[model samples]
Target: MRTLTELLTITKNGRGRLVLVSAEEFFRLKSRDRRAVQPAELSDAELDLIAKAGMPVECAALDAEMKGYAL
Candidate 1:
């Protein structure tokens, strides 16, 4: 399957460049951009739930192993 970026059509214009996308894609992009400016904050209840449900054992093991290795 082609990604959104791959599906996009880009062309050089008189000014610089132009990107052509469908109305749906344009609105999706716009919504994402707006959310990026103001990210949502999690509520206290959500935080409590996350704290109660700790990381999975597999992820914990990976984290421990990664600590022993150099990046």
Candidate 2:
């Protein structure tokens, strides 16, 4: 089996280096996070801040379109 480092694709961007991984690997890494927080447990201020935050216009448009494909 290939090492994680060997399987990754690294690229340079203006901000910093970005690492690309397969969607399977991405979800595998995400699932390993044991410190996930419940939104309901957040304070009112935190919840308000989250609710007030806006997605980028491009992302908002894409999100609207993606709603149609949701299971």
Candidate 3:
């Protein structure tokens, strides 16, 4: 028998009970009810900044990674 660690999907039944299955089986069932995922777009100002900087300039005030940066 397969263990819980080996299972990728655990869904609740009608009585709210848990069900376990392999990733392959989960995807096969998910394909029938799949939806498209969309990405968020950057604003015109953000795009211009990226173009001018030749890359992304993340400031400490705006990003978590640069939180400890002096400037």
Best by TM-score: 1
Estimate candidate 1's alpha-carbon lDDT, on a 0 to 1 scale.
0.65
Which portions of model 1 miss their true places by more than 4 Å? 1-6, 11-19, 29-41, 66-71
Kindly report which residue stretches of model 3 are placed more than 4 angstroms away from their true locations once superposed: 2-16, 34-71
Give me candidate 2's TM-score against the actual structure.
0.38
- Summarize candidate 2's per-residue lDDT along 1-71 as a digit string, tens digits: 66553455465675447677667778888999878589988899999999899888777667767876957
The sequence of per-residue lDDT tens digits that candidate 3 reaches over residues 1-71 is 77534654444563535667777767777889956443346677866886787434644445776678998
Stretches of candidate 2 off by over 4 Å are: 1-34, 64-67
Q: Scored by CA lDDT, what does every candidate get?
A: 0.65, 0.75, 0.63
Q: Total clashing residue pairs per candidate?
A: 0, 0, 0
The superposed Cα distance between candidate 3 and the true structure at residue 46, in angstroms, equals 37
Candidate 3: worst 10 consecutive residues by lDDT? 3-12
11 in model 3: Cα distance from truth in Å? 12
Best-to-worst ranking by lDDT: 2, 1, 3
Q: Lowest-scoring 10 consecutive residues by lDDT in candidate 2?
A: 2-11
Please estimate how well model 2 matches the true structure, expressed as its whole-model Cα lDDT.
Answer: 0.75
User: Candidate 1: deviation at residue 64, Å?
Assistant: 2.4
